[model samples]
Target: MSKLTFADMQNPLFLHPSDGSSSIQIEKLHGPEDYRSWRRQMEIILTSKRKLGFATATVTRSTEDATLGDQWDSCNNMVIAWIHTNLSPSIKKSVLFFTTAREVWKHLETRFALSNGSRKYKLNKDSYGLKQNSTSVYDYFPTLNVIWEEMDSMNMLPIITTVSDEVKRNLEEVEKRKGESKLFQFLNGLDEVYVPMRSQLLMMNLLPSVETASSVIQQEELQRQLLSNPRHDMEMSAMFSRGQTGGDRVVVCKECGGKVHLSDKCWYVVGFPNGHPNHGRILMKPGSMNQSWSIWNKNNPGNKPKPAGNVAGSASNAVVFSPQQLEQLMQLLPSLSKQPSKASKTDDKLDSHFSGMMSYHNALNNDLGWIIDSGASDHMTPHFQKLIMPTLVTNLTPNIKLPTGDTVAITHM
Candidate 1:
């Protein structure tokens, strides 16, 4: 048997003109994981360049013509060059001495394509198991389409039709079913909010194209946005409207004479009629009707009719005085006497005394002594030193009258 020569592998009739076009730049295969995609891309390039026959053809040496031998060597070298440029450096050593493209191609196939069954199994599992989860529809469908296309190319997907039709109706039906399967898978991966839309799609006699379905889903998303944001809808409406008032209109409050007053802020709601309860009432000289009413309405800029005037002997009316009112009036006379008919001056002293007393009481510490008193009718202190946390009572009137007609001065407690 004679060893094969380059002439025997050359095809004399094969002719292809050089066009000075760049080679298709397929990505270099990194490892076993990249084999399938790399192979697909390289095959496309080889076919387009009219060099696929060189890669697929068997090498044999039956003739030794010098011209044929040179042509064969040129074709083989071109194929080898193309293959070598597209291989990663790590895998180059194994195929460095390969004289024919077939050898290199076959070696790669044998080494990496061993896991085809496992690859097919994994692809099938992934295709069926894919879910939208956190992925958006735009992001998710492309991935699914890629997987579907890969499966179809591998002949891994089941054949839906074998019978022939003149118009290729059977083929169309197969494609339609494939589209529906993809649509169903996409819908399944969607959130439950799309359940109604999914049902509508499923119920249709013919499913919409994926692009159409995507558009509908996008519209659904817009509708969802509009539904969730009422303020946004209102703003959009307002933008389209012709100079309409956009928010709650301000109305004049009848009671407080203010604009946009809340019901809670209304004088009537706050338990004050005729604006404020204290607005038109006299604080001193409860018995004198004429003098009190004159002073009460003196500051009224709007001459509004006094509601208290009609109800005689009402608390706001000058003729009325309860026992507590009478006592308060008697106490006011001394304070008023010092200022002699100047009510504002008398009010200042009264406010100062009450405020000062309240401040003093609040300042007192709450820590009480542990000392217990038994059979005591009245509170008593044995000595000042025995009072562990005594607070000095200051600036108050000296004496407090007891029920037994005795008055005692409060010093410290």
Candidate 2:
């Protein structure tokens, strides 16, 4: 039912007392805008009171509880006071709160009784009771109304005479099942359900089949092999060369006899010292250092031929760090433990480095905004991105050859 207006005095829920305190002082307030302002004022007052060492608590209402109304009865005065003081005088208003449910129920029952009987209650009856069916009076009412206007018709006699006891019982059962089934369907759709194993298997069988196909292909290219001819080991080379020209054999590298990059492979194995034992290749096989070097080159294509002139005079050879930069790098010292001995300093040197690193590190810990991630596999930071020409690495050891004496290590914070 729609809410009862104050004019509906019989509505117990909307009751206004006739005597003294029962009368509501409804100092009308504008809508939500004024309500919010009043609420804010109450908060400020409560906060101030709390500051003055007075205890205060805010009792809020759940939707259902508030609708029930009992809690608001005693607080009616406080609500009125709040509305009057906090809201614009033009908008503020007050109303009395009812305390009992009995009054509200009584008013509602009275209002219901006064409503037009024809509108509130629909009357119906069955005619032509042909089969003398037995059903509850409630069940007969709808059938009665369906044929009510036709009651005078001779053909109407058949319907009124005939409902079976079994039919009535069956209808009741069907109605009950319908209600239960609707509930089950609603709840089942909301959550997952376990299926019987056989049912699951049957569902799986009904699904469409999935098909996958695999293929293999082979091809040979021999242009490079045919082009390159050599003289150093003629006879043995002849046997090798003949196999390619006449035999079904397909060779990949005519220059170096390797499958991967021929030009690059030729340079390393023949030109660089590390290959064939005839040359002394000092750098370890391409790994982290080489990857970093390649990445740096890729990022800085313009850095080719020589270092930039602006950086030429600086300790371009030595690593650089500002005092603040040095302080920031110190935190990363803890993470160095993950590196192998070859990649990091000895325990004593690290301890010494920590001692120096921490002194500066601790002083700036609060203000410096730095983090030590010894656990990180590689060093990275926002510090590098911040500079006009950001020095990306700090506390770096330069020309510090590894035991192999070919590659160097640089540390950064």
Candidate 3:
């Protein structure tokens, strides 16, 4: 097969057994189709590299050929003879390359099995001089190995390296273009796959005689063309009531004057109650201590505090309070002269310091802002006890009494 036809040149089934002592073995083929498949397998190996070894033994069907079997007793020698004598080095190279890949596969498989099934793994005396608890072949390493295998199959090591470097660069660019479109990620992925084709397109001449050119146009070029053509990206402006716990936020874009909503990407001001029209206003009771201060301020003339004399004891630097200066200082102390703003009285009552039963339940649900009172046996709130009894966690200790001499024992999970 041509290179393009066999672009995927690696054998899928050629996994070397993970046992260290075992070598690859090819079973005898029966039919023509089976033999052809075997030959293709050999082709895949020898076309890639040279020097493959196998584990095989010959059975003497007759006494006459019994002596011949002795020569083929060594499996490695037998395979080497079969490769160099019967097949070209092209086949040899492919065989050896296939073997190497299999060897790598077996190594990884052994590691994966060990990591998954054993608490401790043994190593050779000089094997990388690794630590006791080094990272295993599983985890993210498996994903990386799949990529490596794909690259090896395609004979695209250079391409893989280039793509990896390019990916890093693209990620940096993405970081630079923070808060840009999520669609940009698709462009980044596309660029990695299209690198070879796009480079070829760049090298070709753009002649006038050419009616149309086969192209590997970049997403950036496409984006630029779209921008020039004035086709806007579709987006929606959603006005959220703003009590959402997540970062699902809508921010106006400075460039297009469009609203872009990002979920879990924005921070919210904590303790700010949602949907409160008078949230910014701090209110006091009509005759409370704070209100009394306000009323005294509005009625009193200016009585600005003067700075104490400096170490030099110069009283000249301290300003002599004029009637107007004193009057303005008096105005500044709104707490002393005027009553608290009458506007806040009609608004909703201020939130209480102590949490209600529902609020405590919410805290438990969120795994935050909950207090496990040590001196309690069974839940105090009847509503909470009913709902949380099924999932509640309790200690071995006996029940304790609260300050009001009530006893309850359970704690929340």
Candidate 4:
């Protein structure tokens, strides 16, 4: 026979007495939260190797036989090697003096056994408070599972014995109820967008397994995205409504000049100034018309017209201000060139400051109007349509002081 090498001796068939199929790999214990899992894995590995007794049994040095002592030493060394390899470097030094497997195991058990009242209370508190805020089902479920497993390991779940058929049936019923309760709790923690799906899940006679529910919810989420997208909806409508030789195209509206629909339903008919039946002419305010004339003069330097007073015109006719005529008109009104009153200047400053402050402070909703007041006895607004309870005060009301110490008349409240 060929001599057996060290590599051959290291094989599971030779080194371990059990069947060489099942193998255990202990994951590194990061913290107290991971202790229960690590202990369970360690137990499995030790049991498979037939060295579990080393974790609980004590050896008497004086009376122990040489062969038994050697076996105990080998088992202790193996356990130590396994722990050292798996431990995080930061915690490795703390257990260096542990001479036996039993000592190390007991130390770890005492350190993180979850028997302390305060620790148990905290665990319970955290498990109850846990919510799936902003986290996906895949990410959130694992966090809840970890807590549940830890609670189960601590014997937190209620237990019932199955000694008889009736007892077995009761136990099964209890377990099913507990499973359903957990499923509901998981669903409750999800975002409100999943309310419809959650309701459907609750209606089922038999609750689906957590894995099945997760997969179904994910698929439903994908379908919702596909259906909700405007681009996709447009594509589907185009595909279905298309004729063999391309269907009739959309007709542009003559009134509003929009492609959505016909001119009879045009918004411009109701809204635009010139679109109304009685409003045949385009209405232009005096201030806007003056500004337009100023812009026109600036663009065409040769046609520059000096500032002139108001010009009269028919509803349909335009007021033409020739350069020579405008210059002669400007010489007539010297009062128009006078500086604004002190009160008017102050009012303008206050208005700009108040508007800026309101814009800065009001960040929530832009639709709402800001009411700036200092010591006003009554509230007044220019927006007459926005009045909640309109009891028209007299048209000529006394002036009110603004927050900037400027006074402006309140025409209505």
Candidate 5:
């Protein structure tokens, strides 16, 4: 026992628990596997209980004052017992009979902390091998942080009263290199989908920190999620098209031919849904649906629109020339102007070509200009002599109603 200090005498209860209790509690220490973390927990508890001095050897047993010496012995015993109580059964056997709390704590440190090469090597290997394979960036980052924190604790620099400028620069460089290395490790371990993003990151003039890189990576992840959401929605809509309704019946849209919905909700007929890719697309009017479809169908099946007056004969006429020949014939007059001329020809040759073009039309007594508009849907020319070979249509009758309520019957095909 040593002599009691004046400070100890002045403040006799300075080492007493801050919370006014001495029963310190913590999880049982599980040996070298959790020795560092267990030690941290014990230290925090000891500090809070005002018994850190016992473990730190700051309050030695004193005999100058018998009362102080006894107090010291009692507190030391309490500290020793608390450490033993919070250790595993096997660990307690090694340190339970120690004479002082400080000695026991130091012994545990020397035994487990000094020879931690295996733990450091494992931590390095894990950090090197960790990947964001199936895990999200959010989960992968936290997992990496845990491993990094453990490694940081193992490689902590020695604490000094003051660091020199050279030492400070060295430390800063080491930290910078360490942060850059960690960024590479994080970027490299990500799935191949991040290759473009990784290239962008590497191309930057000043590399970002780990935390910043993580934030950017998370942003990219969110963007990918947003982009993929629409495709997933499209797939789900297709699934619904094939899926059954509540009653196990499939409800189809007559207008769009899709299942699970009606014509009123049809995108092709009513309107495209918001956020759908098909904007500025041609849409069908609800009134012009199946009712008038046959008029435009050109197939000319039965059940055509009823005319207002006397019906016409079968109006479906077969052309004398094939579509290809007609197209070629139509190109002749247009190509004459478009064809580049190497030399100008006399007006006599042009006049002969014009004569052959008019030869297709009959020499009628009427002085009306002829219009060969092949693309016209409906023709109402007064001169009926333009028909190459007139034929009477009697099987099908489609009457055309005049503006004055009187209907004109189509007499010829």
Candidate 6:
């Protein structure tokens, strides 16, 4: 009770962080390069704890009483210790012996904080020079914002007391101009690939703020990430392009409303390229692709090529079944259905058997970039090597058979 001071009653150390040993939970300061960000964080923590006054030298020791003086000294030591805990090993050694919180803070400031002119010049230079070169928009946007924030801090508008409509309007105009400048800066620094995105943003009527523009660009980045994977996209395209390949994973295309390809490098949409059997012809269309072709065909019907008749000697003659032969085939179909096939029937038998089995052979056409296989197969792939990243299903259902005159079911689909 005797050692208790009036300072304890008015400005209590209980509200402050306990001591230097009490670690500041923040990104530890490295050096001058990290000083600005570190300082901003430190200020927030110190201010909340009411110990910032000690660092600033605004909270003074009482000369009138020894008890109050001791209280101030203890608080000052605590503040000084808190700062030290956040410093790098190299920086800690230099300020380790500083007697007061104010002295430590001033020494660090003098060592690290750049002069207004130099810092302002550097920040301005960074704002212009900063580009989303090789990095993602998620990573690059934040870094650009950091530079802009520092620049804004350096060139803050002056506070005015006399309020007027004209002043308010003029201030708003200044803000709009500043926003426009930031928007341009953000768009300009994007990689050349995003020219379409940048153009779209710029073409907006009211002109979006930097924050709005950044959000749009970030979404674009995510879409770009999705579109960049050629394997996934090409696989997706093949689902509809050549035929169905069995998989549960769904691929939906934004352009043509097709289920498989974002590589709307899609054979269905773009049609087959040169050398492909379906070249210069629309192979398949899922909605939009069909509509587009219909419009194109209607617009240029003369340019569309007519299908060519097969040359007589190229393959074989078309067989014409007599009424007697048709009756004989129908009688044989019933007897064929009961017998299990010992050997895997050829793929053409799939339709003949009326049993839905298909040959899961990888007749890979490199020109078409997809395996020509129907989805109604007992196995997804005939070759073991094609199962590059296979997931085994443990729990089993009774294997469904396509009534193939002969379909050999393998262990893995």
lDDT of each: 0.64, 0.36, 0.35, 0.61, 0.70, 0.71
lDDT of 1 by residue, 281-349 (tens): 433222333443344345333343322222254334322335675687688777666676657555565
Q: What is the C-alpha RMSD of each candidate to the true structure, in Å?
A: 18.4, 32.8, 29.2, 22.3, 15.7, 20.3
> How well is each residue in 1-413 modelled by candidate 2, as lDDT tens digits?
98656556432223233323322233233543233233334446533322111112133333677664553443333333433443344433222232232232233234332223332232211133311143332343334333332222212323335669987897677656544433232222221222232233235533221110000000001222344545546867667766655653544554444543444556444566444564654433334343544555465453332321222355443323566756745765655655565443555455444432311111112223532323324343434431223444665656443343355544333
- lDDT for position 30 in model 3: 35
From the highest lDDT down, the ranking of the candidates is: 6, 5, 1, 4, 2, 3
Residue-wise lDDT of candidate 4 within 111-187, one digit each (tens)? 76665576567666776677878767777778877766666666554555548888889878977776776676678
TM-scores, all models, native as reference: 0.46, 0.15, 0.16, 0.47, 0.47, 0.54
lDDT of 6 by residue, 309-391 (tens): 23345423222345675675697666567655633453335345433222233223332233333433223544554453456
Candidate 3: C-alpha lDDT: 0.35
lDDT of 3 by residue, 1-413 (tens): 54433433233212224412213235433332233334445546543432232321122223467644443233234334444343334434434543333343233234333231121122221122322132322232233333333323433223344457778898677644431221222222332434564455446564211112112233434554667763343222122313332345546433223345332331122222556764654443233433433443344323222232222353443324456746655664663346455433312111111222121111112223333222223335434522322465756476644444466775553
Off by over 4 Å in 6: 1-12, 15-20, 230-413
The candidate that wins on TM-score is 6
Error of 5 at 316 (Å): 28
The superposed Cα distance between candidate 2 and the true structure at residue 59, in angstroms, equals 33
Model 2 scores what on Cα lDDT? Answer: 0.36
The lDDT of model 6 is: 0.71
TM-score-superior candidate, 1 or 4: 4
Task: For candidate 1, report its TM-score.
Answer: 0.46
Which whole-number lDDT from 0 to 100 does residue 171 have in model 4?
74
User: Alpha-carbon error at 330 in model 6, in Å?
Assistant: 35
Whole-model lDDT, model 4: 0.61
1 against 5, candidate with superior lDDT: 5
Better of 2 and 6 by lDDT: 6
